[model samples]
Target: MGTLFGTDGIRGRVNQYPMTPEMALRIGKTAAVFFRDKTSHKHPKIVIGRDTRLSGGMIESALVSGLCSQGADTYLADVLPTPGVAHLTTHLAADAGIVVSASHNPFYDNGIKFFNSRGFKLSDALENDMELWILDDHKKPPVIEDKAIGKIFPVSDAGMIYSNFLLNALPPDIKTRIGGMKIVLDCSNGATSTIAPNLFSRLGVEVIPLSTSPDGININDACGSQYPETLAKKVLASGSDIGFAFDGDGDRLIAVDETGNILTGDQLIAIFARFYHQHHLMENQTVVTTVMSNMGLGKALSDMQVTHLKTTVGDRYVMEQMVASGAHLGGEDSGHIIFLDAHTTGDGILAALQFLRVLVSENTVASQLANVMTVFPQILMNVTVNAKPAISDIKGLPEAITIIEKQLGDTGRVLIRYSGTQPMCRIMVEASTKTEATHFCGQLTEIIKIQIGT
Candidate 1:
């Protein structure tokens, strides 16, 4: 009965608490009833998509059963990316969309996220209403008549449709420039395994794909954006122009330059912002990012005369700020970039294409393009904790953080926050040198663990 939604959605180990089949069923029924009441459609339709997790089928079946029971037609787009579900929801004009995957998490964990009819993540109010319905003890409504019961349909071409959409979204000149370009891709053995290879090959790029074979358990098994070392090695060995690594659900991207250097999400965003501004495509000449973004990105944006807005540590918050400020570009430091003019949500493949477009249009290599922003030395430490005690509640934590802030002054920054989806405290420090950042991060993490350790 606790709050079932996190920063992203309801995520947990499979067969546990909010991720259980029973919980999924209830969520589906609750969502169906809520959307039905909000819309005038006689039979509200919900499109469902999932990644290659082993539990995806189990969760999908439970959701479909519950949705149909509430007279909400369900369309299953099996094994598609999260953004694809969002796109298909709006493309099909469905009432809502559901994606069942834990994104970058391992196969042992899973999650459920919802998108409104406009392909945007549901608002907090809507999520709260659904949680209430799930917890309510009111009697269930009568079952619909046999003919009135919702039907389930299979989307046979969902992946193809999404792939084509991404292909067409690229700049027209990309086709000619990308031809004969050698590129390596690491699909994370998740949703992008099939679609990414196909799309890149059709675009006439020499595609060297890794982790395209998904056995469900292999997704994100040391090969995705979270672990770009493998991709970097491949890019160097294959002598490819660049390497693109996608997270499990294809909502995140991390790139490896030709020299085998990994590029952070902030660097990519800086590149895109500069390109968009030079081309007069940047709306309001602004970019939105989260607090977790590197300080160098802010400095780079300032140099370019583009306003930088920082939001909470989530892509949804970034998107909300982008929409509010009329900014066409926003993303997180974790590689979740949103191109408002292109797609409703972050699409790894699409973002990669945009990155490629920058390279092609500028007639530059990945290393040179990534140099658009100079990243300061950053150190992040995740300390496991028994509970999420507020930093103010922890004795001496506030004074210690304040001292570090004053010592670093304007040359660096410090961010201490608890993970929204996990039981840990993240300590991030940026300084002029790696040694300073690492030392300070180690000190902060030890303090946190002593105060809140299990």
Candidate 2:
């Protein structure tokens, strides 16, 4: 009876609650019905893809069975990125696309997200309709004739199509100029395991790939974006120009500088914004980011006389705001960068390519490209509690926060918000220097914990 989908999708630990195989089948049928057109007669078609999660096989089969039961044709593009599913949906003109992935979450978790025919994430309105159908038990099984049962076929070129598209999206000179550039990529052993190495090799970069495995459990296992310490060390040890780490689903990306410094999504945006401007590719010279972006990014954009817009924290919200504002580039601080000129959804592989394009075009190094923006030191700490209280009910919390704000003044910023995907309150502080930011963050977190700790 509760809402079936979370901020991203229907996610839970494998075999638990919403993630059970039975529920997955139900969701698949509901999705097929929602996308079915009675007049098509050729059968509604949908494409399904998944990350390297241990539960992906079970979930994928359940989805296939349910979709077929509705007489909906299905295409299987196994072990592909989330964006690849989105791309294939629109490219092949399928009625819908389904992806089984939990993105940056650990291997124990899994999820199901739908993409509309246009290759964009489904709107809240459409999801609401599906929820209504599920509650009313309006779903109908297929009334298929003996020959009308839908068929499932494999897409042998799914990775090649996505990789080729990413390469073409770059400026022509990038491939030649970045041919000798040395870079390390940690694919998280998920979706990028197939596409990334081929894409970079085709681009002529000296690529060193880590975590390249088909095994599901290996994804994000002390590598990848969420666990960057391993990648940081690898970058230094390999002495590569830099490194890029992707999430399990390959929609998000984080970077390591030549000095082994981790670069967050905000810093990457600032760098790309500057590069795009230098090449006259930044339309209206504006960039879109979430409120979670660092104050340093705003300062960098302002210094360049470029515009910056802030949306809510999620990539979906960023995409919506970008569309409304006619902005071409937008993303979250968690490495979910979107280049409207490249792909409908954020693609980690594409993002890395774009970064390479800029470096090659300007004949610059990764460290030099990174210098386009000066990142303020940021400190964030999350406090887990029994319940998430309203921001209004906590007395003196606001006053204490105000003190930190005044302390930082114009040189920094503070963000205190709740984690939508988890039960925790996060306190973030950004200042001109790391020491000052850490001190303020420590002080604020201690105060809030005392006031709200269980």
Candidate 3:
């Protein structure tokens, strides 16, 4: 009875202890029962989508078996992005949406995340209920009666439905403004392969789509948001107006300007925040970001007279903080943006659309999008370390942090975090210049290695 769910969902190496087919089956059954709403006149329906993982099929079958066993109908949207599943769940008025993906994690990892009927992620209380049900061996949902077994159905038009929804959500003027916009899209060879190109083409933008394969292992290997260097090169070589890359689940997005400059989540958020504020669309004049956000973001927001709030590292945490604060925009530095007015979760496609909306409204180039923020030069280094080191309890870690803080003063920032999913420590530094940032980050990393025995 170990904890199966991670920061996002139940993610781990496929065929491993927590991610095994048997566990997936139990999770499906537990979710089916948990989401069973007797008040509804119709039967409960759950939409499930997966990434291009090689193990996707095996896990999908197990999930379907469990859901059907509990009298819950399941719709199989094979190889769709996580955000697409979230959108469809709300569009179809289903009881819930389930996404099978490991997001930016490697091909060997897989997971199951879900959205409740409100088109939002399951709350912590709900997650705890399901976990308890899954762990209690002797306590199970009542076995389905003979005539109540559920059925599995294939959603053959999921892609088309999602594409249509995206197009319809945009203003007609957007197409005319974007007609000559040259853009390159890296689909990460995952879920967006089914929808992004179609969405962009409908908007009358010139779209050059790369890495749009369904090959599971190849996805995000050297492409996608995690590795924007390749996309930056492609943008430079093609002389494209700009480039956007999506992670395996298509909920995170990273971009490169025409000049081959990679823009991170904070920069992108700054662009949107400024645009929304100008148009008076930014509700409450606040933006939510994770603690991992660069200090430059706070400074920029402050200069703009916009309040910025920080939450935990995960996008879910950001969303929770946003909703509680009644904020209109929130996201993580990893490119998980939530335009709460439009969608319920972090959607790469939606974020791209918002960026385009701003670009068209401002009538400016991509490079100028975040010009006001002048992103501080930042460097990050991750080192694999032993499992469960006393990172917070390290003897000299606090002293080292104090030293870095004093050095940074008001012009820079430093952050050291433990990898949520791996045995690693991530050290990040930001300064006025790249050389300074790199040097500072290197010294701090050396200190960590010596102190933590990494």
Candidate topping TM-score = 1
lDDT of 3 by residue, 223-306 (tens): 899999988998888888889999999999998988999999999999888888888988699999998887878888999899
The local lDDT score (0 to 100) that residue 12 gets in candidate 1 is 89
Count of residue pairs whose backbone atoms collide, per candidate: 0, 0, 0
Flag clash pairs in model 2.
none
User: How do these models rank on lDDT, best leading?
Assistant: 1, 3, 2
RMSD for all candidates, in order, please.
Answer: 1.4, 2.5, 2.1
TM-scores vs. true structure, each candidate: 0.98, 0.92, 0.94
Q: Please list the residue runs of candidate 2 whose C-alpha ends up more than 4 Å from where it truly belongs after superposition.
A: 37-41, 137-148, 394-396, 443-454
User: Higher-TM-score candidate among 1 and 3?
Assistant: 1
**Which scores greater on TM-score, model 1 or model 2?**
1
lDDT of each: 0.91, 0.83, 0.84
| lDDT value for model 2 | 0.83
Q: How many backbone clashes does candidate 2 have?
A: 0
* Model 3, position 361: C-alpha lDDT score: 79
